[model samples]
Target: MKTYLQAFDLWEIVNVGIEPPMLRPNPTLAQMRQHNEECAKKTQGDVLPTKQCFRHDLYKNHGL
Candidate 1:
C-alpha cells in the first residue's frame, strides 16, 4: 500500500479527506428563526424527541 505523506507545508492550507471540515455554510439568522418557528407550529411541543436507534436495542434484537 502507498503510504500517505507526512509533510505539513502542502497540507496546512488545504481541504483533504484525512481531516475534512466539520461544517459548511448555514442559513442566515433570519432563515433559521423562521424554520424553527415553522417546526414549533407543526409539533406544538407534543412530539417527543427520539433517536433513530439505540445501541442496546440493536444488540438485543440482532437477528430479528
Candidate 2:
C-alpha cells in the first residue's frame, strides 16, 4: 500500500508562454555554395558530394 500527500504549487501548474526566436530563412543556392566553399577552406579539405551537401549540413545545424 502507498500513501501520498498532494500539495498545489502555482509555479508548477502555470504555463510560461515562452516562444523561441525565429530561425534564419533558408539561404539561396548560391549562398549555400559559397558557404560550402568557405567551410572547405576553413577545414583545409575538399568538399565531397558537391557543395550542396555541405550547405545542407550547415543549415540543419543552424536550425534553418
Candidate 3:
C-alpha cells in the first residue's frame, strides 16, 4: 500500500510538474504582407495610432 501511494505521488509529480510548450503557426510572407496592408487600410484615416484601434481593426476583419 505504501509503495502504491509513492508511485501515485511520483506519477502526479511527473504529470503536473512539467508542461509541454505551446506551438504556434508561423504566417507566410504573403500572409504577413496582407495583414500589414489590412491594418494600414483600417488605420489610414486615423490621426493617432493606437493598439486598440489596430486590434479592433484586426478583430473586425479576422474575427479574432
Best by lDDT: 3
* lDDT score, candidate 1: 0.41
What are the root-mean-square deviations of the candidates from the true structure over C-alphas? 15.0, 21.6, 21.2
Q: Count residue pairs with overlapping backbones in model 3.
A: 0
Rank all candidate structures by their TM-score, best first, as comma-separated numbers: 3, 2, 1
How many angstroms is residue 52 displaced in model 2 relative to the true structure, after the best TM-score fit?
A: 27
List residue ranges in candidate 1 displaced over 4 A. Answer: 1-24, 45-64
Q: Is candidate 1 or candidate 3 better by lDDT?
A: 3
TM-score of each: 0.30, 0.30, 0.32
Clashing pairs in 2: none
Q: Between 1 and 3, whose TM-score is larger?
A: 3
Error of 1 at 3 (Å): 52
Give the clash count for each candidate: 0, 0, 0
Model 1 residue 63 CA deviation (Å) reads: 51
Give candidate 2's TM-score.
0.30
